[model samples]
Target: MEYQESFINYLRYEKRTSPHTVVAYKKDLDQFVCFITEMVGEFDVNKVDSKLVRTWIVSLMEKQLSPRSVNRKVSTVKAFFRFLMKEKIVETNPAVNLPLPKVRKKLPGFVEEESLHHLLDDGFFPGDFRGVRDKLIVALLYATGIRLAELMQLKGSSFDTKNYLIKVLGKRQKERIIPYPREMNNLLFEYLEIRNREIGYFPDILLVTEKGKPVYEKLIYRVVKKSLEYVTSFEQKSPHVIRHSYATHLLNKGADLNAVKELLGHSSLAATQIYTHTTFEKLHDIYKQAHPRG
Candidate 1:
């Protein structure tokens, strides 16, 4: 229990993990602790064996956690055991040989291009203060294929409109420069100028509301949903779908897999491979039309 408190403190202070992440980790750890308490009334975690760990996992399976969720719990337990080992509390890690729960790979749902175009076009109320900003938010996310968190971090100082590039901070604080079309660069520049001059917004963010505050998650979602409502009839619509649309369109137009991987800020090529599935589906359609296989 003392060690758990220390580990949690380390997470909050030393690691600087977010409240949400720390809470999730604690909840996962507590579930294991509760199971151990109920099983034997008062057993030391250091004395736990692989057999006990396996049984606990079997109990978790009966509770119907999804494979992915169970796998995450397994990962949390492994980390906890590793921490104990580092502190010399245990002779061996008991969860070492525990079988990882298998997870299915399902493709993320993304909006089609026609729907995306209609959605973006609907946000083009040029005269209103927030309308223009919201439209650019949607456009820039699609144009650059940046993550929501990365997009939220952008400042007025980051854009290089003259060179048609936007410098972005990607995963693990790594910075990368992404190029955009001339039209996008122009749109961003125009929005920036208006943002600083007419709206009197702090010239720090490329996108902001009327209050000069950096846009957050709800704002981003609202912008995406509002634009989507105007353009397409798809029940599923969000800023991430715009990103998916960008990646999908790139592949449909024959962009290299490696290049798309970097543009999307993915840590691995495997993460970017989902777009290839979209391209393969499109290729099959073209083949069916061009070839007389039917």
Candidate 2:
């Protein structure tokens, strides 16, 4: 228990892991400790063996957990034991020999370009501050393809309107600049005007609540979901869906893979390469419909 807490703190303060990642690692570790305690009547890190770890994997599979979820949990166990090994508290790493299940790769979901066009150009958003702010939220996510956390962490000065770029602090605190349309810059300026009038003063943060406080994750999720429902019928209407649309659309329009990778703040080209699959699918569809080989 002490070790788990210390590991979590290490992830939080030292590794600078995201809050969502830290929470997931904590949950996985807690479940593993519970499994060990129930089987051996005590949770001793040194007492853990490959057999015990295998049994826990079996239990997770029996519960019908997806292979990907099971694999992530296994990764948590491996990371934990690695820490113990480094601290000289464990003689052998039981999780080292533990096997993981293979996970299926699913294509990312995205809204169609026409649907997004209608949503933004049509009379979907309101004329009030909330409407302006909500529309701007959707615009920024789709236009720049930044992650939700990066948008939430945006500051008033994050935008360089003259240069047509917005600086984003992405994962691991790595910073990158993404260009935006001149139209989006004007929209943002209008939103800030309304925000200033409503709050009676400018807040240091961007994308704040109606009351002028910094926006949280859930609120942004709701804003994106609700705004998207106005134009599309997709089941997944999260901010990430908009991000996927941004990437897929860029690739569909013949944007360079490496250039799209930079806009999305992906650490590697491999991560951005997934959009190519969707782009190829679209091209195949067009070929099937337009080709007259028959």
lDDT of each: 0.80, 0.90
Candidate 2 lDDT by residue in tens digits, 104-166: 988999999999999999989998998998999999998899999899888779999998989
Q: List, residue by residue over 54-112, the lDDT tens digit for candidate 1.
A: 99898988999899888888777887788778778887888887786789976666677
* Clash pairs for candidate 2: none
- Number of backbone-clashing residue pairs for each candidate, in the order shown: 2, 0
TM-score of 2: 0.95
Cα lDDT of model 1 overall? 0.80
lDDT of 2: 0.90
With candidate 1 superimposed using the best TM-score fit, by how many Å does residue 197's alpha carbon deviate from the native?
4.1
